[model samples]
Target chain A: MSATIHFTIDGVEVTGKAGQTILQAASEAGIYIPRLCAHKDLTPHGSCRVCTVMVNGRPQAACTQPVSDGAIVENETAEIKELRRNLVEMLFVEGNHYCMFCEKSGNCELQALAYRLGIQAPRYPYFFPQRALDATHPDIFIDHNRCILCGRCVRASKELDGKNVFQFIGRGAHKRVGFNAPDGLGHTDAAVSDRFVSICPVGAILKKRVGYAIPVGQRLFDKRPIGSEIEARRAKGK
Target chain B: MSTKPKVATTSLAGCFGCHMSLLDIDDRILKLIELVDFNKSPINDIKKFTDRCLVGIIEGGCSNEENVHVLQDFRKHCDVIIALGDCATMGGLPAMRNHVPLKECLEEAYLKGPTVYNPGGKVPGDAELPLILDKVYPCQEVVKVDLFLPGCPPPADTIWQALVALLNNKPLELPYELIKYD
Candidate 1:
């Protein structure tokens, strides 16, 4: 068997077993690549486009792209930073994201990502899409406006709970989440205990009746950026 | 082209963010427009059409009389009526104030509070606005809904995948990563 392959990240070489995504190698070597869509427990989706890197002079999503021997990856670059800023701008314009008043204001992934990327104002015209809030369920409140569509909750429904209750509908900009049957969440097959709510990455899908329950300073991931949290978790092998 | 479905969308009561989010599919909007006939969205003008569409999406909550009528019309016209966004599915942010009484809201917003034309007149018995329901409710509370897409609004890619699944008659399956809110 051949030995592990070594790759260079930000001019520092890192070695890892074959078939690891660039994010894995970067995290292993204590290099931080910002990401919004990549989760340790769920399958990686390059939807947010925040974890992009310059690999051998090409822009690629570190979460989805795998590493190979002798490959050189640039985790930080001016062009990559600009691209991330644009991606964050698109996400901001694509929905009615008013983070200032949101309960998840300081703890939000989108907000954190914006801070990391230094986004001052949404450059694009706001889509100002009209979204809804679902509080019929006794345990969860779904806020459609803030959703970035990372699809973590959808995956949790399918994988952990084995209930195909939540789903996406329509195409393109007209797309949105929906239940399998004609009935709303109350009438659908999903239960309150389903893991979908816990896995949601934004305030869009929330735990019903639990807003502000966690004190301002006590919320997890509120103080530290996701990059640091990921590094810490990796350090602990979690 | 003949086999593709015709889809229409509408919103009521709550903000129109869901419809706008749908339009946020960006370049994919052109691709979707190519695949279906978008007949009666707020963004488009399709007059004198009723009950002939394949898919009908109604965003926002049914808080007023007009909302009720619109939902009824969608139910009558489309083969499937999807309650898109949280408001459509469960009475969103507007419903947050559901704990308070409607008269109290009116008094604060219109009569007792700030006034452009302090309609010093007594609260009209027959305001054009529909009477508020006792408790805020989702679209399915008033009419039949074919599907419910949760999220504050579901992610764009998830929405795309769902639509593709519907178009292809395949089971809609989103990766677990799409569902997390944290």
Candidate 2:
């Protein structure tokens, strides 16, 4: 017999099996925590900090922090919302995110989260850093301008596909995603069918010849706001 | 003089797609006419502002001295300035040029490449031409934008709703469908 863990998120009692993280349990319980780096198929990485929740009055990443009996989790409070907004805004200004022309505009998780957080415009000054595009690969391309360095592609490439093609280079502002080969993506053994291809949360990693295929006003986030599906599932659970 | 609220609009270093989208409001423009008066706008073909405007709607980013001058003029003569498209909000497509040096861009366009018919074509240095800025800048970076309506071109219904709300002195109510970044 498996042990069960009980927790309260925003005062709502939720239950989960033992050895589940707060994010996993909350998600199965129909609660939504905004996240960027954590995906269902891959192991949890608490790099983005967008899913930081108060666990027993201390801040911890919900994705990495394991749930325990009688733990009080605060996911949606004013302080957390404002912190998330600032983090989101910083991500915007840090990248050359020209969302208007991006192929991932409506479908991008970052843009959807910005809308979900009510970010009309970034409060910080735009860096407008000069970044390069890698069109060397025939099937796929990488635009460094839009990358947030959440390490999704690196993790997916290494763990899921077992290709180990993507890795992080440098540190801080100079840090960026790099391919295994020195000549760029063309020389790398990455395939279009790799799991990393679809795991990107933004327009940084894109497949060729599919730009604007779905058309505007009809993408995933266009039909419904982010977290609405989970919230809908929560409503249905009652 | 008519007591209707006066509004003006302009497009800087942008495609006039936003203005076209404004026309996309269909017959709702008639309701807009009843609500506000067009002052200096391409719709009215008014060359310049002759009177103070209650609202100034600007589309596109500033890429040259003339765009800056026009934006400043609007700021001088208008009470509220609205950055009315993605270009005006974040430099948009025109900002793609920010990666390359302006001199290289000008040389490629005028002196080199396949498009130039004249072999000795010189860069246009006419005294009458507006001097280009080193890089394109969003409207907010250049001026104090009172409001921003972001999209490649914000949908016409979104424009209509914002216009109506501004004219009625109410907070603009943006529904999910109307608030798209692209």
Candidate 3:
């Protein structure tokens, strides 16, 4: 920590150390800034714009944008909330998210975020795009239908797990997660024990045969909305 | 002739789970009946709409010609159309077949499926049967839905809150606890 960098998130004064991103700073300050793709253990890829914040009137991804001294950050505004909701909806329509039958139903970050945003139904039409499921890996599987292209798994694998197991291939709408090995995930160095295996915010990547273990009401985000724990920190004190 | 606002409901390409959830309101059913008259709802076994309805609660999506026609009729006769449940709002489970071709789906369902016992090896192509669309579509794609109450089947409490608000002509703002997808 170089020095204490103080900032205002939504007009509430918060402080952080040097080199800390707005998200990390806000998380410490107990101000819940909604995000996906930017995990604590992973490098901030900023692919999912769910955590976009206004830094002195400029829209920036909070995860990637480092905190500066006396910076004016707007986390929750009517306009920002609307943009986040729309971005989340795009992620919904862009994939084949059959949440009713999905194993990640309650624990899924995507679903929890949608609920937190009060999005009963997305305004846009469902694309219902064609996607595939890769179950070649005996321990873990990838369902492209639920992938938000957030790059969390990619970052986690390379930066944390130290294995170049996952990578994105193709262009634009055709872009999807591909493996390092010529063969399927089973052929790759990816393992069930990899940190990337547990880093997926959505159910796109899941471990084999362990789904629905937590039960319905006991799952995360079931009792309370996402970010409650972070906000609870603020309620406790400064 | 009751002065109460009339409400009509129908299940299209749905499993009637939403309707079941509506009934799951339990004792509130009496309150709901007191508040609104059943115009064309199956609950009252009324086949035809004898009068214009205040609210038309749609239970599912349009997977066929009949569903489309029924939704169109709702739009015509009802002042407000509420798309109730995931099926009506997002095409729900039936939409899983959207990625596959219609021919393949038909063959899988009517002929090639493991449980199929079609000795005639014939797809049901009767003139009376409604023709299935290429893919299931949400209600909003076909008609203007005034509101959407999403869930597999929105909880009974959720239904009660929404219906009460809608009936009272109040701005619908559901508490976070009442809203859920599954």
Tell me the deviation in Å of residue A197 in model 3: 1.7
Per-residue lDDT of model 3, residues A107-174, tens digit only? 99999999999998999999999998888899999999999999988888889988899999998989
Lowest summed lDDT across 10 adjacent residues in model 2 chain A is found at: A118-127
- Sort the predicted structures by DockQ, highest score first: 3, 2, 1
B1-182, model 3: which lDDT tens digit per residue?
68899999999999999999999999989998889899998888898899999999999899999999999999999999999999999999999999999999999999999999999999999999999999999999999998889998888998889889988879888877778888
What candidate 3 keeps of the native contacts, as a fraction, is: 0.75
Better of 2 and 3 by lDDT: 3
Clash count for candidate 1 is 57
Ten residues in a row with the worst lDDT in model 3 chain B?
Answer: B171-180
TM-score of chain A of 1: 0.89
Ranking by TM-score: 3, 2, 1
Tens digits of per-residue lDDT, candidate 2, A1-238, equal: 6699888999999998888889999888889999988888889989999999999999999999999999999999999999899999899988899887789988999999998887777767677889999999999999999999999999999999988898899998899999999999999999999989899999999999999999776799996888888788789899
lDDT of 1 by residue, A155-183 (tens): 78887888887888877887788867675
**Superior by DockQ: candidate 2 or candidate 3:** 3
* TM-score of chain A, every prediction, order shown: 0.89, 0.98, 0.97
Model 2 residue A114 CA deviation (Å) reads 1.5
Output the better candidate (1/3) by TM-score.
3
Off by over 4 Å in 2: B118-121
lDDT of 3 at B79: 96
